[model samples]
Target chain A: MIAHAIFFYTFSIIAVVSAIMVTASKNTVHSVFFLILDFISISCLFIMIGAEFLGMIMLIVYVGAVAVLFLFVVMMLNVAQQKNQWFAGQQSSRHIPVGLIISTLIFFEIIIVIGGWKYKPEIFDINNSISQASISNTHSLGQILYTDYIHVFQISGMILLVAMVGAIVLTFRQRSGVKRQSYIKQISRERAEGVEVLEVQSNKGVKLDD
Target chain B: MEYLSAVFQEVYKILFLLVPVLVSVAMIVWLDRRVWAFVQKRQGPNVVGPFGLLQSLADALKYIFKEIIIPSSSNKVIFILAPIVTMTLALIAWAVIPFSATQVLADINVGILYLFAVSSLGVYGIIMGGWASNSKYPFLGAIRSAAQMVSYEVSIGVIIINVLLCVGSLNLNDIVIAQKNMWFVIPLFPMFVIFFISALAETNRPPFDLPEAEAELVAGYQTEYSGMMYAMFWLGEYANILLMCAMGAILFLGGWMSPIDVYPFTLVPGAIWLILKILLLFILFALVKAIVPRYRYDQLMRLGWKVFLPLSLTWVVLTASYLFYFNLLPVN
Candidate 1:
């Protein structure tokens, strides 16, 4: 229990610091790196809390794929030289109050949610049965995900698929006069098509035009 | 006192696993050079020790003694952090690799996912190093490598699903045990092949090593690194290659399992069998480097996306359907 607490505190501290640094950093590339660090520390917390699958998936998806794409865009755009100017311009100063209002509202909503949270008595029964089964964390999660929430799970997957297709559709373009490799045509070339057996080929240069 | 003892024991076990791995990385580097030399009909690194056994050791010493010149314009902090991240992440994935039934560090339920997650994070090291260098070639190499790894990872994920469809468990040990009757290579041969090729691409080996194409990128992301820093990248690359080889052995070749069930084969320990399997796969990786030419960037992307992605996706469907139809899926 002590070890768990120690780890939880360490990871949460790192995560919070990195989260702040994500926006506070001047360099865009540094911001992305801090964002990655934020994701990693949060995932470490998740793993420490016994949700290994979710933690690992979070690392794979967020830190691995999304953050990499973020880094790629940042690097390619050469945006690291741009200084953070949220408070610099007189024009930008007007939005600060609005941002503060919105952020405070979010903070209150999270506080209310945590303050009102309570475990139902039946939840204990469900937990008892799960522990009795002695199944692995992944197995138990799969059981619930596939059975109790199958439709929701599948709908989320479908939504992702649609989003992917939409992204592809949005970006895809066709170029005119571009030569593309046709593997079938290349592989199916025949010797007979190019060669002709002519009786008097040598005399008139095989009547080349004909 | 008891807590201290437990912590010490854990550290000891980690060292037990890590020391051999680092040593083996050194040895594998020598083997890679020797194989390349054999292919080119020349003696490779044979002067230092017997058959050039100490060549990698000697290289390590040279790297240790050399100067680490950080580029003046580079992002100094991240520039230093990159190779450390690379080498550390490469080594940590070994924590979950099971040498035998009982020889795992953390027999976590989601071991395979952990491995996947760690390996996927590997691109950051290169990207950090490249972007931090503040040079065009390294930056280009970093982008190329990141795209290549991410593209290949999609297919690798789908291919792993095919294996999971058979084993129905994410635990690496459970995966090996599920193959007691027959190795996954027999039934999922196509997936195995795609996985091997994707592993090659993931580790940035030839012919997928367009990231470090010498004729173009001049050592890729390592262009600005020198001395121990450059050596760290080299060590991390070979370690990642070994990790991939070990993954192949465990996933397809039935890791640590004796090929034959006879008395003599069974007499040898499981760790030895696992090592031999990894060595065999590593040799194939080295041989591929010698025999195949490097791929163009466009061709590499095309192969990963158009060819392997759809193929692996189809195989996943087939494997799932077949397992369902026959009721062969393991019920965990």
Candidate 2:
């Protein structure tokens, strides 16, 4: 138990620090790297807490796919080296007070919620919940995901499908200037259509364009 | 004190495992060169040790002694951090990889998913390196790598879902154990092939190696990297290739299980069998590299998005429904 608590504190500290660095970093690329570190540390926390499947999934989804996408966009745009000037512009300075006020409100709300919440001893009692030792986290997740929450699962799938189609529709374009090979057209051409035999071409130069 | 001792024991186990893996990776480099040379009818490195067995060691020594160059315009911090990230991610993924029934360092439930996630995240290394170089070729190479990895990753994910459907488990051990009667390759041959090809693309192996195309990109993302930094990418790439091969073996070829599992076959240990399978897959990877030509950029994208995406998606649907219809899915 002591070891677990030690590891939890260590990983959480790393996670929190990195999460702060993500926004505080001057370079956009460094921000992405900090975001990755944050994800990794949080995933470590997840793994330590026994939700190994969810932890690994979080790593794969956030660090692997999403973070790489962020890195790709940042690099492609060539904007990583820009100096981060917070409240540099006169107009930008006007929003600083509003941002601070909102953040303080959120901080107070979180504090209040935590302070007011009461933890019942029964919540920690294992006898009331499913036996964790008998089944892996993934097994239980699958059981509930497919059987009880099947509709929600299907809806999420639909949402992903819609997002994919929308992305393709938005970015896909056909240009008239570009020349592309049409394999069907090339393969379908017949000798009669492609070649013309003229009797007068033996004595005189053939009029190619005609 | 007891917990401290336990942690030390784990660290010791890790060191031992790491030693063998590091040695194997070195040997794999030498083997790849020799095999490729043999295929091309040329002599490879032969002066180091007997039969050039220590060529990779010599190369490592040379790299260690060489000067590490930092490009003047490059992002100095990220340029160094990129390879470290690459190497660390490559090594950490092995934590959940099972060599046998009990050889895994961490027998997590989502072992396969962890591997997938780590492999997918590999793109960040290339992107970071390329971007930090602040050069045209590396940037282009990084973009190519990012797109290629992302495209292939989608199919690989779907293919893994197909395998998981048959096994009904995400645990690597369970996936292997479920194949006791018949390896998945026999039933899911097309998925096996598709997964293998996708793995090749994911690892940026030849035929799909447009990211680091030598003739065009001039070392691609590694353009500005030198000495030890460059060597780290080499180590990470081979490690990833080996991991992919191990994954292929575990998923489709029944991992450590003997092929026939009768008489003489059952006499051997499971770990040895797993090693043999990995070696075979490595040979296949090398052979393909030697034999195939590099793919054009558009052709590679077409193969991934057009050919593989639909095929793997269709297979996923077919696999799920077939398992349901025949009631052949493994019970949890």
Compute each candidate's TM-score over C-alphas. 0.93, 0.91
Which ten contiguous residues of candidate 2 chain A have the minimum total lDDT?
Answer: A80-89
DockQ scores for all predicted structures: 0.80, 0.75
Give the poorly placed runs of model 1, Cα more than 4 Å off.
A84-87, A94-98, A118-133, A186-210
- Of the true interface contacts, the fraction found in model 2 is 0.96
lDDT of every predicted structure (CA atoms): 0.91, 0.88
Q: At residue B195, what lDDT does model 1 achieve?
A: 94
The RMSD (Cα, Å) of candidate 2 is: 3.2
Error of 2 at B229 (Å): 1.3
* Per-residue C-alpha lDDT of model 2 across residues B56-105, encoded as one tens digit per residue: 99999999999999999998988998898888878888888787788888
Pairs of colliding residues, candidate 1: none
lDDT of 1 by residue, B1-332 (tens): 99999999999999999999999999999999999899999888898989889999999999999999999999999999999999999999999999889989998888889889999999999999999999999988998999999999999999888988899899999999989999999999998889999999999999999888899999899899999999999999999999999999999999999988799998899999999999999999999999999988988999999999999999988988898899887884
Give the per-residue lDDT of model 2 (tens digit) for A109-170.
98766655545545444442334689888877777789878999999999999999999999
